[model samples]
Target: MNGVSRGTTWRMYKKHKFLFMMLLPALVYMFIFHYMPMYGITIAFKNFNFSKGIWGSDWIGLDNFERLFGTSSSFLRVLRNTLVISGMKLVIVFSGCIVLALLINEVKAKVFKRVVQNISYLPHFISWVIIGSILVEMLSLSRGVVNQVIEMFGGTPIYFLTEKYWFLFILVSSDMWQSIGWGSIIYLAAISGVDPALYESARMDGASRIRQMISITLPCIANVVAIMFILQIGNILSAGFDQIFNLYNFRVYEVADIIDTYAYRIGLSEGDFSLSTAVSLFKNVFGLILVIITNYVAKRLGHTGLW
Candidate 1:
């Protein structure tokens, strides 16, 4: 049976040799960039050393994880912050993208729709570094636009970033602004793929635009949304590293410090590479479990899943 299966597979490969050739570059790229780096996961199980290197380090087998969850680690605090921020983003940004896509699809004016799409896409391309600097300037106590406007109304200037709740608001809002358009692109494409006849039939049945969107458009794009949502859930532990890193400070660390930033500090600054790798591994394992469970639930609920 094995011999027959191998021969059949070889024949199939030979039949589609050119198609496989077209896929060669991606396969090679994935191997070199992604698969090759997986060996570094060993660092998580070893006492990684600068001199001895990842391979030569002494095997420590889960000690790093023990240290990670130790009382002094602050892992629980960072985990809480990560979940809070990522949960907010998942709810706000993800749903906002879908709403934005639906609104764009309903626009009758082609020129205005295109202008809005282009403008929305522009923010996604702008570097987070520049956005961070802009935020700092716009929120500055002495000369910031927000402060200036507040003072104009005879109100005291509020330093926004340092305050925890205000910082959380800014974090979630800025994340939404940066990502919504780009995120909506997938939903827009999915929306475009929905048959126009469906909408027309809904209209003939006296279904309003909102009703059509909810009943026809959304159902058609639900699989795509599910796949995207599952992917997002898989990275729930990530929160937003680059944004928070650039915008956060000592004052807001309680709210802003997430798993990635915590790892960055310990790995690069404190030189605890092993614990850092373990922390990452811990996060990724939970992520994988979430993806699997979510995919299973999605499938059971009659939605297409990542598998």
Candidate 2:
């Protein structure tokens, strides 16, 4: 019996040796990059001083969180902005990418399809700083192409920046422009997996192109869509710090500031390390809770989850 068991173990190990080897790099990368950073989260609770170090820093408990939630603070506003912007981005970007992928899947001209895909993806490769500068130039009151067109029509130029009401729209639009094609890549892959026979059967049954998409294509990719939605829900607190940070200024803070940017400004810029750490911790904890809850719901609903 012992000899048989040893033989079975050795055989199994031999069979999976290559698979295990392939997984080693990814496992190590996750341990280093993802799990390692989790230890730093304790800085949120302590009054961290560089000279004293994280371990030797004094424990302030909830003092940082306390001051943030206190009255006369912009914490709530920042939180609200984060949710609104992130929620809108997730919904719009998610749906738009799927739709774009579907439309691209329908195009019969291969060269034209490839051209469209490349063009749409180009903006994503550009730096946000360059994008922001481009936006500033194009939307400028005097010299911008938009203003030139407006002047041609005998209209006054509008100030898009430095305005609270338009800030959310600007953030969402630019983000969408930059990300739409890149986001669609996953959906396109899902579309490629859809059986060609299904579309053929639909055509034989006299189904319109739109009907085929609605019934066959959409259902085939439903699992992918559901998983993406759940993952996006997990990051509800994150509002694209890099993009927003590049485009926003104090003039539009009322509508434009998000949790990440606010933390950077209050903690790093102002040197309120403890308070900033508290806010950072709050954001991370809520995000963790959201991801868990969404994943649970997805699992219950018979969808792919992040578990």
Candidate 3:
């Protein structure tokens, strides 16, 4: 029995050796970049001193966190901004992507479909910095194309970037536009995997295109939608920090700043690293809770879920 088990283990190892070899680079990268930096999470609990270093830093036992919550009035504001903006973006971004995928699926003309797909996907490759600059130019109060068109229509040029009420709107809209095509890729792939026979049957049953989409297409990809929703819900605290940081200004900070941005300001600008770490730690803990709850809900509902 022992000899048989040993031979079976050797056979299995030999069979999967190439697969293990293929995964080595990715495992090494994960260890070096992701897992290594996770050790810094401890700074959240410690009153970190540059001279003393991470290990030598004095243990403050939540004093940093106390300062973060008690002293910073903007803590709640930033948290609120993060959640609200992220929630809105998650809905709009995913909905837009799904809609684009469904619409593109319905296009019978192959040439036009390909052209539109390529054009939409092009924006995903552009950096947020470039997108921000382009947006600024296009929305410039004086010489922008948007203003030019507005003036042509005898309308006043609106300050889109600086307006408090409009900042979140602009952030969500631009985020959706930039990511819609790229985001649609997964849905499109899922749609492609769906059985064509389902569509044929729906057609034979006298279903219209919209009806077929509702009755046949959506149900087939429901798992994919659910999984994506779970993943998006997991990151509800992060609402495109890069995009907001680049596009926002002090004028719209009340509405535009999120936890990540506030951390940057307080930690880097104000030299309060310990407090910033606490804020970040708080965000991560809440994010962890969200992921756990979402995954649990997904599993109970009989959908594809994170394990």
lDDT of each: 0.94, 0.88, 0.90
lDDT of 2 by residue, 190-296 (tens): 99998999989999999999999999999888889888887788788989998888888889988888999988988789987777778888887898888889889
Error of 2 at 193 (Å): 1.0
Between the candidate structures 1 and 2, which one is better when assessed by lDDT? Answer: 1
Expressed as tens digits, the lDDT of each residue in 103-159 for candidate 1 is 999999999999999999889988889999999999999989999999999999989
**lDDT tens digits, residues 13-57, model 3?**
899999989999999999999999988878888888999988899
Winner by lDDT between candidate 3 and candidate 1 = 1
TM-score-superior candidate, 1 or 2: 1
RMSD list, candidates in order: 1.7, 2.7, 2.1
Of the candidates numbered 2 and 3, which has the greater TM-score value? 3
Highest-lDDT candidate: 1
lDDT of candidate 1? 0.94
Model 1 ranges with Cα > 4 A deviation: 1-12
Question: Sorted on TM-score, highest at the top, how do the candidates line up?
Answer: 1, 3, 2
